[model samples]
Target: MSSLFGILSAAGQSLLTFQRGINSTNKNIANVSTEGYNREIPVFQDLPRSGVFMNKIIRVFDQSLFSRSIDLNQKLNSDNEFASGLSNIETIFNDALGTGFSSDLNTFFNSINDMLIKPDDLAARSQFLANAQTLVGKIRNTDKALEDLKQQTVLKVRDQINQINQITSQLAKLNQSIKTKTLDIEVNNEYLNERDRLIKQLSDLIDTKVVFNEDNTVNVFTAKGYGLVVGIESTQLSFETDSNGNAVVKWNNVADITKEIQNGQVGGNLKTIDKVNEQLNKLNDFVTVLTTVFNKVHRQGYGLDGSTNTDFFTIDPSKSGTKIDASNVYINITDPKKVALASDPKYLNSDNTNGKNLLGLKNNISNLYTNPSQPVLTPTEEANLKASLNDPTNYDFIKTHTFAEFYNTKLVAEVSSTSSYIKQQQQNNKYLYDAITEKMKSITGVNMDEELINLTKLQRSYEASARIITVTDELMQTILGLIK
Candidate 1:
C-alpha cells in the first residue's frame, strides 16, 4: 500500500507537469499573430526518486538578434524620412510637368531672340516684357516654395518629438510592470511584449541604444549617449525656437541636442532643412549675377521712347543687405516702349545695333547645358559689347555660363544626385531590416505546426500520467482489501 501511494504521488506530479507543458504550447499558438510576442517554453526538472515537474516558463529570445534589429530599424527610418523630404524639394524644381524657372528662363531669352528681327516692333517688345514678368514670377514663387518647405519640415520634427515623448513615458511604465516578469509564478509575457514594442516605436522617431537589465526592464539612450530612460524613469525631450525662428531640439528642456540627433526621422529632417538653406544661398548668388548682366545690358540700349540707362530689372538692395536674390528681383520696366532695342540712342528704330549687340551677349555666354562655347565675338562686335560690359568687376559667372545653366549645374544637379543616393540607401537598409527581423522571428515567433505537435504530445503524456494514477489507486485498494 505504501509503494502504491508513492507511485500515485509521483504520477500526480507528472500529470501537473504535462498540463503545464500544454498550457505553454497553447499560449504560443494563441499569440502567434501578436507583434513583439515571444514563444514560451516549459522547463521541467526531475525530483529525486520522483516524477518530473515543470519549474518555470522561459521566452525564446536571442539577445544579439534583437539588438541588431533595433539598429537597422533606426537606420531605415532615417533614410526613409530623408527620401520623403527630398522628394518635395525635387518637385519644386522639376519642370517636367509644367513651366518652372528653367522653362521661363528659356522663354524670356528666346523672346529676346525673336525681337531682334524687328527692334522697333511694339508688339514684339510687349511680348518680351510679358515673358520677363513670367520669368520673375517663377523665381519669386520658387523662393517661397523653398521657404514653405523648410517651415513645414520643422513642424514635422516637432510632431515627431512629441511622439517620442509618448513612447518614452509608456516605456517607463512598462519597465516598472515588467520588473516582476520572467522570474516567478507571474511569468507575464504582455509586459515584455509591450516594452519591446515601445522601444521599436521610439526607434522610428530617433536613434536609440537599448540596454537590457537583469530585472527584465530596459534602459534606452540616444546613439550620442544622451540617456532617455534610467531604471523605471524616463526623460522627456523638448524643443525651443531660436531668435531666428529656427527649431532647436532640447534634451530634458535644458540642453540643446539638435546636432546630437544624427539618425532617425528628426536627424533626417534637420539635414533636409540644411540642404534647403544651402540651395537658397546659391540661388541668391545666381540672381545677383543674372540681375547685374541683364540690367547693365538693358541700360546700355535705347527704347522706342529714347529711354537709356534705365534699369530693366530692379531690386531693393537695402532690404537684401549685400545683394539681390530671387526674393526681391523683379522687372523694373512695365512699358513695352521701355524695352531697350537699340545699342545706341541715335540708331533707335533703324540701326538695330543696340538690340543686336544685346542678342550677341546671350550667344557669347553660352548655356553650359544647351550649347558649348560659341565662336568668339568678332572684334567689331566685341567693341560694341564693351560699352555695356565695361564693368567686368560685376559679372563673374556670366563670363562663362548662362543664367539657366549656372543654376542647373550648381544647385539642381546637386539636389538630384544627393536625393538619388539617399533613396538607394533607404532601399538597401529596408532589405537589411526585414532580413534581421525575420531572423529574430525564427527564434522568437511561434510556429503553428510545431506548437500543434507539441500540444498532441502533451495530451498523450497527460493521459498516460492519469492512467498511472488510476492504476496505482486500484492496486492500493486491492492491497487494502486483503489487509482488511
Candidate 2:
C-alpha cells in the first residue's frame, strides 16, 4: 500500500508537469502571429525519487541574432527615410516636369533677346518684365519648397524623439517588472516578450545597444555610448532647436546628438536637414554669381530712357540680413523705358549689343562641377549652344555664358547624382535588412505546426501519467481487499 501511494504521488506530479507543458505549447500557438513574440518552451526536471516537475519557462531567443536584427533595422529605417525625403527634393529640381528654374530662366532670357527685334516696343519690354517676374516667382517657389522640407524634417525629428522617450519609458518599466519576475527560477515569458518588443521599437527610432544583467534587467544605450536606460531608470530624449527653429536631436535632454545619430529615422531626418542646407547654399551661390555677372553688363549698357549705373536685379529689403538670394532676388527697374539693351546711349533703343552679350551666357561654362584643372566649357553646354545656333547671323554674337548652362551642368547634375546614389544605397539596405529579418524570424518566430506536435506529445505524457495513477489506485484497492 505504501509503495502504491508513492507511485500515485509520482504520477500526480508527472501529470501536472505534462499539463504545464501543454499550456506553454498552447500559449505559443496563440501568439504565433504576434510581432516580436518568442516561442515558449517549458523545461522539466526529474525529482530525486520519481516523476518530473516544471523547472522554468524559456523563450526561444537567440541573443546575438536579435541584437544584429536591431542594428540592421536601424540602418534600414534610416535609409528608407532618407530615400523618401530625397525623392521629394528631387522632384523640385526635375527639369522633365517643366517646373524647374531652367525653364523660367530660359523664358526670361529669351524675352530679353526678343526685345532686340523691336528695341523700342513697349509690348516687348513688358514681356521681358513679365518673364523676369516669372523667373523671380520660380526662384521664390523653389526656396519655399526647400523651407517646407526643412519644416517637415523638424516635425519628424520631434515626433521621433517623442516616440523614443515613450519607448524608453516602457522599457524601463518592463525591465523592472522582468527583474522582479526573474527573481524566481521560473521567469514570466510575457514580460520578457513585451520588453523585447519595446527594445526593437526603440532600435527603429535610433541606434541602440542592449545588455542584459543577471538580475534580468536590461541596460540600454545609444551606439555612441550614451545611457538610455539603466536598472529601470530611463533617460528622456528631446529636440534642441536652433535659433531658426530647426530641430536637433539631443540625448538625455542634453548634448546635441543630431550628428551622432548615424542610423534610424532620426538620423535620416538629420541628414535631410544637412541636404537642404547644402542645396540652399548652392542656390544662393548661383544667385550671387548670376546677379554679379548680369548686373555688371547691365551697368555698362544704356536703358531706353538713357538710364545707366542701375542694377537690373536687386535683393528685397524685407529679406535683409538673410542669405539675400534666390527667394529675394527682384528686378530693380520699374519703368518700361528702363530696359537696357544697348551699350551706347545714342543707339539705346535700337542697339542689340547688350542683348547679344546676355545671349553669350547660354554656352559659357565654368569649373562649377568639373575638375578645377579642367576649366573648359562642358560638352553638354556647348552642345546646347550648337543645337540652338541655327542662325549664326542672329545668334552668332550671342555669348555662350548663360545661367541655364551653369545650372544644368552644375546644380542639376550634382543633385541627380546624389539622388541616384541614395536610391542604390536604399535598395542594398533593403536586401540586407530582409535577409537579417528572415534569420531573426527563424530563430525566434513561433511555428504553429511545431507547437501542435509538442501539444500532442504533452497529451500523451499526461494520459500515461493518468493511467499510472489509475493503475496504482486499482492495485492498492485490490491489496486492501485481500488484507480485509
Name the top TM-score candidate: 2
Which stretches in model 2 have alpha-carbon errors above 4 Å? 182-187, 365-402, 478-484
* Shift in Å, residue 405, candidate 2: 3.7
- Tell me the tens digit of each residue's lDDT in model 2 across 372-455: 354333456445434433232212222344566557755577777877887888888788778887887877888777888889
Query: For model 1, how does the per-residue alpha-carbon lDDT over 275-377 read when each residue is reduced to its tens digit?
Result: 7877676676666657755666677678889888988778855445444577888778788888887766777775565565556555454322122343234
lDDT of each: 0.78, 0.77
lDDT of 2 at 453: 86
TM-score per model over all chains: 0.86, 0.88
Instruction: State in Å the error of residue 340, model 2.
Output: 0.8
What's the number of clashes in each of the models? 2, 10
